[model samples]
Structure formats: C-alpha cells, structure tokens
Target: MIPRHFKLLLLGAAICAPIFSSAQKIKAPLPNWQNLDLKADGQFGISTEKAYNELLKGKKHVPVVVAVLDAGVDIKHEDLKKIMWVNPKETAANTTDDDKNGYADDVHGWSFLGSAKGSIQYDNLELVRQIRLGQAKFADPKNIAPTDKEAYKAYQKMVAELQGKIDKAKESSNNMLNVALKFNSMVSKMGSRNPSKKQFADYSPEDPAETQLQKIALENWGTGDFNNFMEEEIYGAMKHYREQLDYHFNINFDSRDTVGDNYADVNERNYGTGDAAGPAPDHGSHVAGIIAAVRDNDLGIKGVADDVAIMSVRTVPNGDERDKDVANAIRYAAANGAKVINMSFGKGYSSNKTAVDDAVKFAMSKDVLIVHSAGNDGKDNDKEPGFPNKFYEDKSGEAAAWIEIGASGYIDDETLAAPFSNYGKNTVDVYAPGVKINSTMPGSKYKEQDGTSMSAPVVSGLAALIRSYYPKLTALQVKEILMKSAVKVDHKVTVKNGDGKRKVLFSDICQTGGIVNAYEALKLAATY
Candidate 1:
C-alpha cells in the first residue's frame, strides 16, 4: 500500500527538506530547477540543490516508455523537435510501409485522422441527433427494422445528455451573439465596423463613433490584442465557450454523421489520411512541446524531459474522439516502440470501450505506460465514469499501467484543481499544473490553455523523467510510485458544483485530493 502523507508535504521546500539524502531508494526531486529557484545568480539551468539531494541524489529504477495519443504533435517545434520518436526502418514520404506496420510514411507515429473520412470532430451533440431521429425512426411503422432495445436505451441516455449540450451551446451562442451585437450597436454609433484591442483600450468614448465602437470591442473581446493573440489564444477560448453553449445551454445541433465509419470496427484502419501538419492539430503541437521539446536551445518553452523522442500519433479530433481511433493509436504507439503515451483528451461516452480497453491492456502487457487526462467538465465525477479506466480486471491480478491525471493551477487546492477538471474517488490518481498553463501551440506560437487535458502531459513528462532515468520500473510500478508519493493536499478549498456554485473541499472531487509534484516524487524516488 502507498503511504498517505504524499500530499501533506506539498507546502514548500521546508517540509521536503527532512527526506534529503536518505539511504533508502525512492523517487528524486528536481535537483536544481532553474525556474523554481527565485534566488539564483546569472547562471541558468537547474538551481535547487538541497531538494535535489533528498530526492534524486541516488535513485535506481527502470527506464520506462510513455505513449502520447492526442491530436498529434508538431514534431518540428524547436523545444519538441529533438525528442520526437523516430521510426528507424520506415522512410519518410517514400509511399511504402517500410516498417510493414500498415501505416505509410509513419516516420514519427500513426495518424487515425490521416484520412478525410476519419477526421470529424467529437460528437458533442450525438445524443441529441440520436434522440431527434430516434422517435421518428423507431415509431415509423414502415421502417425496415424495429427499434433496438439496448440501442434505444443507450440512445435515451445520450439524448438526455444531448439536451444538456444543446442547452449549453444555445446559451453560449446567444451570449456570443449578444456580445457581438452589442459591439455592433456600439460601433454603429461610432461609424466603425470592428476595432482591435489596442484601439479599444486607447480610445475615448467621447469620440461618439470611436467611443461606441471601442466599448463594443472591449465588451466583446476585452482590451487584449485582438489583431493577434495566437491561434490557440482565440481558438481555445472559442472552443471552451462553444462547448459551454453546446453542453450547457439551449442550442442543440448534431454533426456525428460526417464521420461515416463505425468506431467499433478495428478492421477499418485505413480511414483518415493527411499530412500531420494541418489546421486541426494545434493541440498536439503544444502538448509535444511540453513533453519532449528541446531544451537549452534558447527557443520557446523547455520540455519536461531531455534525451527524449516524441511519437506523433494523431488520434484525437476537435471534439469527442472515437473509441476505435483511440484504440488503434495505442496499438500504433506500442508497436512503434513508443516508451510513453500522453492522452490529453476525453468525453462522457464510448460506444465501443472493449477495443480501447483491450488495447490499453495490450500496452501494459508489453510494459508500456499510458497517461490520460481526467477531462474538463468541472463536475464531481465520483458519481460519473470517464473512459480509459484500466484498474479493474476479470478476477485476475493483471491490470494495465494507466494513470488518470486531473488539472492543477499555479496556486494550491481549490485553485489547485482546475475548476473544469473532472474528478474521481479512486479512478483519477493525481493532478498537475493545467490552469492557464503556458506551453507550445500551433503555428509556431505559444499560449495558455486550461483543462485536465494539459495536466495529463505534465504527469507524463514526470513519468518520462522517471522512465528516462530509471528504466527498470514497470508501468504499474511507476503509476504506484507517482501516486504513493504524490503531494497529498488536505486544504479545504471551494469547488464548483454542477450547478456552478462554490461547494466544499477538493477531496470530495478526486480520488486522492493532491497534485502530481515531480519534485516530491523525485524525493521519494531517491530514498524509497
């Protein structure tokens, strides 16, 4: 069993100083992180010394591999380029499957969205579509087949969920329209169409036309750089707002029809095909930069691990991902010798969990570790279930090496867990910094995104840190070590309930109410 005080020691270096340089073998802390040490000379690179001695001074563990199964990585981001996993046998753009692994030109990894038919966004409104079409299809006397009881039941649940999405989408869409219209009206009096953030910030309302337009712009997008805020800056905001509208408001549009293939069909492998460089893969690029992005290159942000290789497996879409794609991506990572898998995506439904579950089991059997996001919905999830949980087995001791991570903020507790993060009593193992996190995005740009999606990779990065240094630990052991020595938080912070109200402590939200601190984990790694 894992020790319980992992979280009690999250206050600061003072509490962690006791475990320094012990003879016991345990996880190590960041020896001297240049970023964490506020009091350092002109020198750069690692800085904290005392914490390092107690953590990673003399640790012994296995070098494990992590698999990142997300939209896809840029693979070229300066910080992420060096560590991208390379396929030794496969030739790039040669039009031949050199590795004989079914994917063509899979130099880095596989892409389930490589084809057009497989590249549809998540079915945020699938339940609504099923529900709207259900009664018509089921009640139609001339229909060729009677309604499936099980399918109907499933559809019913999804439809109820659809109602929720539709309501949310409608509300957000209306709010956006209101803001846009208000801005339009304000600008109308000023005789201007659209103004940038700079213009709005510097303008005076006394100018009649200019003033109205400025007010409109300020209200709509605020006094930020409207001309350029990076793609993710606006895109991330838009995505979240739209999801709020679709999932929480009154507008209910469905678009699950675009992706024509059934997600349960493993035989349907060759579906999506495209160059990894596309408009939709912005999320993947940013995540890649965080995991293995090249460091000390005087580039953008530094990745978590050095001496790393990233595998770009494009399995996620703009919305809910299909089970088949997720499963196939896992297999691709495992087959391509991927050491780690980072999954920064999730949804509330899975039509075919068996395939994804089996693939997770397969990866664990092969000693591969899978890290995933706990999701962005701010609801207490101990009452709900998220996809890709592998802790259970069929009366056997065999369990997949899986880690479910929640989002953490710069501040501890309440603020520690990103309000949008989904939590579980025993399912989610840990949390990491995910709120307003600064990382790489698409278009050679960097921005901040908030979600458990971002939190998962940080844990994956720490896992990679352990795996890269100590390769002997199996996937399960790594998961145990991470959780066992986690910074167990006991602070009673407020949480956002489903009704969007402040509630109680975060412990009511996740399995273990603590964040994944690499520093502390390293400390345990050194002395455990």
Candidate 2:
C-alpha cells in the first residue's frame, strides 16, 4: 500500500492550487491543533495539552517503548534522536550478534525488507501475483476441484479488479502525459519555465494550434501562480502512473530478490539486514514524530506524550508489505519490550494472514497494544477487509490489544470526518484528528500530512501515555479506557462518499461514536 500522506497531497494538487502573494505570509492553522481540547477551541482534537497540564502534572511516569512499524524511521532526527530505544545488550558497529536475538548490531531496531545489497522499493500487489501464478486454474473453471471451488471464485474476483486498475492506470497515464506535453510546449514558446497564466494568455499566438494548446493549459493549470505545479504535480502524477503500469502491475518483476527471502516461506525470520532506516524514511519519520516528538524543544510541535522510547521496525516499502516481514516485525516489537505498536500500512489482499494473526496474538499475550489505521480508501471497512486487520476472512477474533482507528479533522462541522478516511460502524474503534497534521520528516525537517496513518499514531501516542503512567493496566484495559473515555459527537456529519457527500451519523462510522480525548483517557486511567 502507498503511504496515505502522499496520496492525500497528490489528491489535493489535482483539485486546487494555492493562490497567495509572496508579500503576504499565510499563517499556518495551528500546528498543534491535534493536541487542543474540543470544548476550549471547538476543534475535534484529543486534548493532549489538557492531559499534560492537569492529569500528568507532577506525576511520575515510567518510560514506555513504542514500536513504529512502517517504511523506515530516521533514527537521527533532531527531536527524535534522544528518545530512540537503544538495545542495551547489543554493541553497535560489531559484526557479531551481541544480544543473540538472531540479529546483528540492531542497536535501534531491525529491518525485514533490507539486505546487504539494498532495500526493495516496488512490488506487485498480492492479487496480481496470485492471478499470474494461478492463470491455469482461472483460465478454465472446470479444472478446479469441488474443494477448490471457493478459491477459484476468489481468483476470478481478484483478476477482474486487477484488470480494472491496470486499464485505469494506462488511461490516466496517457491523458496526463498528453496534457503535460502541451503545457511544456506552451512554456517553451513563452520563453519561461514558471510562466504565469496572465503572461501566457497575454502573449500573441503564432497559429491556431498554439491557441488551442494555451486554452487547454489555462483550464487545467489555473489562471494564477504556476510555481512547482508542472514539475511536482504534473510530472509527479505521470511518474506514479508509469510506475503503477510498469512495476506494481508487472507480473514479471520480482521485488523479493532484493530482500533475498523465499516468497513461499512465512516461518522464515531473521533474514534481513540491520538497516532500520530503509531507503525511504519520510513516512516512518512522520509517524515516529506524531508518537513521540520531544516536548519543550521550541523547534517543532510536541508529541502527545513527553516520556517515551521509540522502537523502529522497518517493514513497509513503496508497495504492499510482505506477510513474513509483518509477522516478524510484530514478534520483534513484543520481544523487545515495546508496549505499543503503531501499524499504519494496509492492503486489500493477504497471502498468509494466519502467520500475521498468530503474531498479533503473541503480541497480545505480552500485553502490547496495536493501533492500526482504518485505511484511506474512503469506504466502509466493515464490508471490505484490509490486511493485518483485527480478524481474518473467517471472522475469528485476533487480539484484544488491537485498536482500529479512522481519520478525523480539526473542523467540527459537517466535514468532521477526513474525506479520504475509511470508516466502519463495526470495524473501526475511534476517530482522531489526522488532516494537516504537522510532524517530523527526514533531514530533521517538518511537514504537514493528512491520512489515517497520522491518526493511528495519535492513538498510539495516547496508548503509550496510558501505559507509561498507568503501568498496572494491561493492553486490553488501556484499550477499553481509551474507547470508554472518548468524546462522543451528538450530531450527524457529512463525509465524502466517492465523488459525492453523504450524511452519516458520527456513531455509525465507528464503534466508539466519538473522537479520542487524551485528557479523558488519562483521567479514567487514574481511577483504575
């Protein structure tokens, strides 16, 4: 699954362009809105500031370790460096496995997608791979056995969906490239790379062909500022579509060769290198910052909790994360004393869900909380399954420690729910502020992102807060406290349903019927 943050940004670029003068600086909508109290500011925030001020004031807290399972975390981030979970038993820069945990020099954490050569950046979806592998079985239904009837049916559905995606990708790629070429040709005629709409329009047209091209460019690129839109937006979209058509949908490309792991084996662990920070670190860095960016640094925004040790477990890549890596990541988090695990990546298919489920159970047994994103597909999660979910296809319960989260927004109006967030009355547990969330990025920088990926870590940070202060509470108890203490909304809200808006009760989107409140949860934890 692609990181939800980038998807939101790209989606925004397609619809709107920022119109502002260089002289007039636009003030950012408060960077710490997610930490504000709803009653005080009329925003759908988690009241993190209130929690620290009232409940956690002068209280002693234990240091809780939180594991971030995503692409990769920048361990050396300025605000995050000091809070990284260091392996006390393992020696850094040593060739030997000092701790004897079947990993070498894993000082910060481990990477299941890394090897001596490099990290994997692209892979075909499991559904695409399955279709390629079972082409014979799908080609003729009569060849399938009675017991294999159900599997054959599943293959048919997967093939249909894959074909649709491929067709859509090809069409979009062709359309974007054509428009970009026309736009670039106009820019060349104007003799400037960053051409204003007025400049292009005011210029004399050479022929009927030039007039037609300029008309199309003006309609798509807008009649205002055109800074970075051509390169970052148009070119970016083209690159994504090209990659989708070439790599993600290509059955011939095997991404597993980079990791040197057997694709068929799920039990194999301890096969990857110790490069916790994989090829891409932006996604995981943002996630880590949301969970535990240092407070009082006066440089960037403070995290939900001040006292926490972040454990980095790199597993996710540019494409769908493999099941074997996910299972091992969970086991590593549980075994290494990580009390809370934040899993912000998800896909539509699962190859070996049982292995992942068993690992989830193992983490639950160790009393580790798992906070997962409900996904960014803007659909009901109760109907559609996302991998690493709370339950398998059979509906057997996985873990009590698990918390499924949908994305919320700072605005408290009809658009409270994030337009792209996936929600479900039965599947999702609670909602949290996720839109325009400012957090850490790579190179010790900060950026605002939007996604349930951001929302999941907000809850993970709250889980770490509870576990830190209320050390006696089990993972399940912490989950119950968080859900029971959420701030319930009383009115219905309008959410994006495909291209149109639909009015839905806030309670109908999630089981909690409320936005998570860190202050309320901590207050409830004090009673127990």
Q: Using TM-score as the measure, which candidate wins?
A: 2
Off by over 4 Å in 1: 1-66, 116-154, 184-224, 229-264, 267-274, 391-400, 500-506
**TM-score per model over all chains:** 0.76, 0.88
**Tens digit of lDDT per residue, candidate 2, span 116-171?**
87887677777777888778666777677898888887887888888898997787
Clashes of each: 79, 0
Alpha-carbon deviation at 489 in model 2, angstroms: 0.9
lDDT of 1 at 328: 82
- Which candidate should be chosen as best, given lDDT against the real structure? 2
Off by over 4 Å in 2: 2-28, 136-150, 178-192, 195-231, 392-396, 496-499
**What does candidate 1's lDDT look like per residue over 1-528, in tens digits?**
000111111111111223422222222223222224223332111222323444555654443344567767776665666666777898888778877778778777766764544454334422333455666766753443554666666666766776665665455445434434544554465454555565557655553433433433344352245544212222333455565454432235444344455544665765554345444666777677666566568777766665567777777755556678888888778877776788887666555667777787778767888888877666655677666566443434434577788776554424555556677766777777665455776666775555676677777877787776667666777787788766666776556676666755555656566666566566565554
What clash pairs does model 2 have? none
Per-candidate Cα RMSD to the true structure, in Å, reads 10.4, 4.9
